[model samples]
Target: MYNKRFIIPGLVIFVLFVTFPLWFNAFSTASPVPKPELPPGGEKECVAPASEMRDRHMVLLNEWRDGVLRDGERDVITVGGKQYRKGLQMACMQCHTSKEKFCDTCHDYTSVNPFCWDCHLTPEEAALKKETH
Candidate 1:
């Protein structure tokens, strides 16, 4: 036995709920793409190549974290014959200063909540919060 009358309403309710989050997110204001500023010399190159960094940053960070915490390593990474520190605060955040402008833009766009921010604060974000009365 089939109830065609009930089927249509049930499907409509299911679809509405299923798509509601996507619909609401789409209509919400989107943050602009991040344009991270370089340091005083206007140095443009990253320690690793840009394409590799774009795809493998998380992997590199995880490796660095493990090397530091688990192995008790001093966390020096050599890339392209140059040495660099492995800490996000030391290396990465030097360029990607504003987490709101840089990290949050892409994370929000992709709907990802990275654990990085939970443990670390960008230098710009370290400022004291203004209290409201």
Candidate 2:
């Protein structure tokens, strides 16, 4: 009602500031999400389909952890006639051998620090250690 000159500009500035991020990004091209490196072996199969693995790999790994540690379900799994041990080191790292190439790219892109390493070594390194010991 009062000070139309000052009040109008102040409201305009506040609105622009609030919407700046949305509008700024709208006019600019966003960086595309990085594609993860595939297995070096060129293996075409995974325990789950590619879509499921992309979206829910963390959940799947968590389930594996709980199943192995809590339920003692350490049995082998068969998929597409291939046998896989019910563990990360034994199954996953066999093909996804490089942590940086296979794991870190996507994990870094999403900015999630998974606690998987707290209790387990990078599975490939663990495998090497086992062989040497």
Candidate 3:
């Protein structure tokens, strides 16, 4: 059949396209992402468990954002039966003082550029901007 001529070449091209990323990554020299260091002051834990916070911090933050901005609710969040105020710059940054070392490590690893920085800045970022100008 005339169609027989195209089938072999088409299958070869299809296989190549499907497996390109695996081949390219095997040849590349990319290093693994480093883990974020804990904050100073020996803070023992987050409002939630380390596993929950690592996986779902963004979901928590988004709920906080909606509560604060849209609903005008400035209430404390209860996690692990402990109450913590619900504001990023006010509460979260109290422990996570270094945004670059703490936040950027995970965010960069996942290729996520959170817009939290669009409105908020770490104490260090504010200081740097003041010094630059």
lDDT for model 1: 0.73
Q: What is candidate 2's TM-score against the reference?
A: 0.70
Residue-level lDDT for 122 in candidate 1? 68
Per-candidate Cα lDDT values, in order, are 0.73, 0.85, 0.83
Clashes of each: 0, 0, 0
Model 3 gets an lDDT of 0.83
Tell me, by lDDT, which candidate is best: 2
lDDT for each residue of candidate 1 in 68-106, tens digit (9 for 90 to 100): 778888766664455668788777766666677666766
Which residue runs does candidate 3 get wrong by more than 4 Å? 1-6, 76-85, 130-133
Say which prediction, candidate 2 or candidate 3, comes out ahead on lDDT: 2
Candidate 3 lDDT tens digits, 11-117:
88899899998888899987577688786756676777889998999999999899999999999766445567898877777777888888988788778999998
Please provide, for model 2 over 59-87, each residue's C-alpha lDDT reduced to its tens digit, 9 standing for 90 to 100.
Answer: 99999999999999898987667788988
Quote the lDDT for 42 in model 1.
50
Off by over 4 Å in 1: 14-41, 77-83, 127-133
Q: Pull out the clashing pairs in model 1.
A: none
Q: Which window of ten consecutive residues has the lowest lDDT sum in model 1?
A: 124-133
